[model samples]
Target chain A: MEDNQIKNNSNESQKASANYDVVIIGGGPAGSTAAIYAARSGLKTLVVDKGLTSGALGITSKIVNYPGIVEEISGAQLVEKMREQAKLFGAEYISDKVIGVDLQSETKSIFGNGGVYNSRFVIISTGSMGRGVRIQGEDRLLGHGVSYCATCDAAFYRNKDVVVAGNTDEAIEEALFLTKYANQVYFLSQTERLAAPQELVETLKNHPKVILYAGTKLKEIIGENRVEAVLAVQSDQHEVLLSVSGAFVYLQGGRPVTDFIQGQLEVSQSGCLIVDSSFQTSIPGVYAIGDVLCTHVKQVVVSAAEGAIAAMAIEKEINGRSRMMVDWSEKKQ
Target chain B: MNSVIHVNDDQFEEVVLKAELPVLVDFWAPWCGPCRMVAPLLDKIASEYSGKIIVAKVNTDENSQWAVNYRVQGIPTMLFISKGQVVKTQVGALSESGLKNLVNDFLAGKN
Candidate 1:
């Protein structure tokens, strides 16, 4: 009976999902710009973003160099403005983290944490804040003990020791979650003090199951098959090894965000997505822009310009046009 | 015609370990992001490879007993069991082709 209910519910949800003409990932300058151009061109567009501050522009304190905006503005506020503009142009924005994608099929399917979206075109503008380097044995023990998601794997480590590395709020929240299942939770922050909110930090510090290790660098993950221990350096001299069954690493690095693609698309040597002059990737109907490009200039105007190019290219492809459409002419006035 | 069975702690032995064919058991929950990503793929495999293999899902949120017994320290942990013995394990989301390759390898005894 329950199985039938589940199947029916899944089918209903799948039916509820509306097919879109374009699905843009990341709502930063590039993604929002793409949404604006695509939606204004009468194409049904949807933008899926993790959050306001998920991209580099989101974390930027002040963006004064952006053209047409004389006032000093925060990256988050600027992004919000772009998002609003895109929405005004008929783009639907949803706050959801894209977990995976299947771009080979005619209708590309983007899987998010909340729901799935199907579209004719996909834009890759997730930026360069993705993790690039892996500690020793981290890759080998990925399924065994090394995991990026704590919520997914924390339950499996019941009564076992685990380590949560990183200083972000996400890492702290995961560490706190692990306390419920794991016998002990070791919180390792590379910084002297975590940049996350103070209340969350205090809670993690005061938690009975947590052992806080600040200003530590994770040197390596020591294990044969699964995670047996973690080798870390404290204060640049002291080496600490903690026995653990799991290692939840939320570390961030400066590389193109392509993990979600799962090696289906082409990337450059530095892990940046390779795109043509039109911002179209190696795969047809797929586009990439902004900081995800290796030669990308990390500027708001640059990203926005790239987004415009990609969106126009997408519009051209969708309409089967040999020449690109120039919309600068006064709109039939 | 059998889809992926939502096997519980009690039915695990009979429905999976003692199944007629090898079973690809997925330890998952609704809240897990990667688990959500693997769900649709598992459904397709369950239907397409019905007689060749059994795709069993153990929702760890409710049925943690078997998951604990298997020492599955990850969600979406696919344990390939042949003849009631664990043969292979994959612990995260894979691309569509990646999943297909893993399934083919599991069926080919190369896992």
Candidate 2:
């Protein structure tokens, strides 16, 4: 009976409508920053999340580059501080995983674990997740040899021959890191030109232990029960065999996780949210921010700044509407 | 809390349609998964572009008439209106940059 009541209450919350000034999704840096700004601006804002801790920051061990921090700090600690600050400013935090959104209406409806929330403005700060490599025997040998994050698994392959497949800056960076511990690091790039930054390209070129292969695609990760080697095809149309003990396959490319609203909101070819300078989507009262956006850069600081900007914009909009209401009332009197 | 504007159909025309800046209307409904994904993104954009744009949301399930008038066939639909004219319509979840580019284009009179 109690379970039924809880379920019924959850359903009722979805149906019981109350208009909020601003509703923020995600509690990461971007979402937290937006909440702080919105609450400070005197907006009745509500922030919802699935208790996923910090976004990417949660996974990082040490963050040395963020501004204002004198000494190095853990990513998790920084995120905790940000959360504390946002909460202090009267930003309502709710533990809920959002399942749907209604952006076509005058009042936006957000459906989630906590039920439904109606708001004048909605902001999407949900970031992207890492993609998995699709290959036979890869899933079964995930823990044995196949890995994505080099930092997490680099120590396991110390003094062993390892292969890293990718062409982006991240891939190159990971390969360089692997070179620190591995006896030999095979950096495989599917394209002729290295897609990494110039500095990384120079470093990879100079490294004696690193064998940079251009126009080579990883065909399969071969191993009996553990990763032993990887088969590849060179640009010269020749099959090349590379022997290694461990393999790191980086699959950074994938469609955005916006399939939930198939026909609801405007999405780009890459599955990113399409917004204007004001961060407004095709639907009114709806906004988007951070890496989820279709932009050139997907840095953490940039996304946080976007969140702050969105909060301030919503505050001004609310103020403008109220002023108009007051003026009309005075005129009537 | 002070900045909040409780607007309904009765006052939408005056509070949103007749506003000075471009009005961004978010048409959303409950039980929408993508809408949930895009909610925080919208909030961030609203705060970022505060003085430049007007952001608001409409619940389609409650305000069925308004949703029908706009021909909203999906959840989380966003409409960009400028000077009382519907300038652009986005039909799916969008990223911050994606939405910002469109808003910038609208602000720059690019339509």
RMSD (Å) of each candidate, 1 decimal: 4.9, 19.7
Mind listing the fnat for each candidate? 0.56, 0.08
Q: Once all C-alphas are superposed, what RMSD does model 2 give against the true structure?
A: 19.7
TM-score of predicted structure 1, chain A:
0.76
Error of 1 at A196 (Å): 6.4
- Tens digits of per-residue lDDT, candidate 2, B7-107, equal 56666788778989887887764444445555666777677778888777776545656655665545566778887778877755555567788888877
For candidate 1, give the lDDT of residue A82: 96
Candidate 1 lDDT over A120-182, as tens digits, reads 999988998888688888988887889877656666787999999987666787788678778
TM-score of chain A of each: 0.76, 0.56
- Per-residue accuracy of model 2 over A212-330 as CA lDDT, tens digit each: 98899887888875678889889888998888877887644443334334457887776668888768788877888876675726666777788877777777687875331211335
lDDT of 2: 0.69
Model 1 chain A: ten consecutive residues of lowest lDDT: A1-10
Worst 10 residues of 2 chain A by lDDT: A321-330
